[model samples]
Target: MSSPRFAVAQLDEITPTPCPCGQARRAFKEPWNTLATVHLTDIHADSKAHYHQKMTEIYIVLEGEGHLEADGQIIPLKPMTTVMIRPGCVHRAVGKLKIINVPMPPFDPADEFEV
Candidate 1:
């Protein structure tokens, strides 16, 4: 027998964890999988700026109005806005927001650094 070619995640059943942005519900994560993982993050008003060493992240805003602070540059954002953050770029989302984040190479806590 062969393993299933796909995996499914019930995000609501997942526990939320404190992250730099706010709280996050990470799904579709596996140690053997090195491609990517997805997270549902709630952006807090005081989201902290951070960066990843090698992982690339794509942020898709699902709700709220705000801006993306990337290396001191402010990029306005709204619902449905998408931004691709590359490795080593310090970034953070401002204001109240709900977003879906896709992290390439999966999300590694050890790779995240506060800026």
Candidate 2:
């Protein structure tokens, strides 16, 4: 048997970075893990609509109420609301919200696109 290949991340301890959604703390961004990447996103009123070329994202709302605009369609968001956004879909969060975003194949800045 081989050693366990895994990692643990403390979301709150990670420094938040500026994102279109306000702020985000991304984890597992290393190339070693190509499976997925997790992000703690703080959504603000100024969040902008954007898309990913080759990444799929799963968002789990954690706090606050809001609406997710995807491909021009708005969907209500609340605590425990989960949304799966595929590649090429333009989406953004309206209102103040905190969500957990998981991106498949990890997150690559090069894959993010603004429409």
Q: List the residue pairs that clash in candidate 2.
A: none
**What are the TM-scores, per candidate, against the unseen true structure?**
0.93, 0.93
Candidate 1: list runs displaced more than 4 Å: 1-3
Superposed by TM-score, candidate 2 places the C-alpha of residue 65 at a distance from the truth, in angstroms, of 0.5
lDDT, candidate 2, at 94: 94
> Candidate 1 versus the native: TM-score?
0.93
Local error of candidate 2 at 21, Å?
A: 0.7
What are the Cα lDDT values of the candidates? Answer: 0.91, 0.90
Clashing pairs in 1: none
Give the alpha carbon lDDT tens digit for every residue of 81-115 in model 2.
99999999999889899999999989888888877
Model 2: lowest-lDDT 10 consecutive positions: 1-10
lDDT of 1 by residue, 1-115 (tens): 4545799998767899999999999997776677899999988786888999999999999999999999889999899999999999999889899999999989999999998
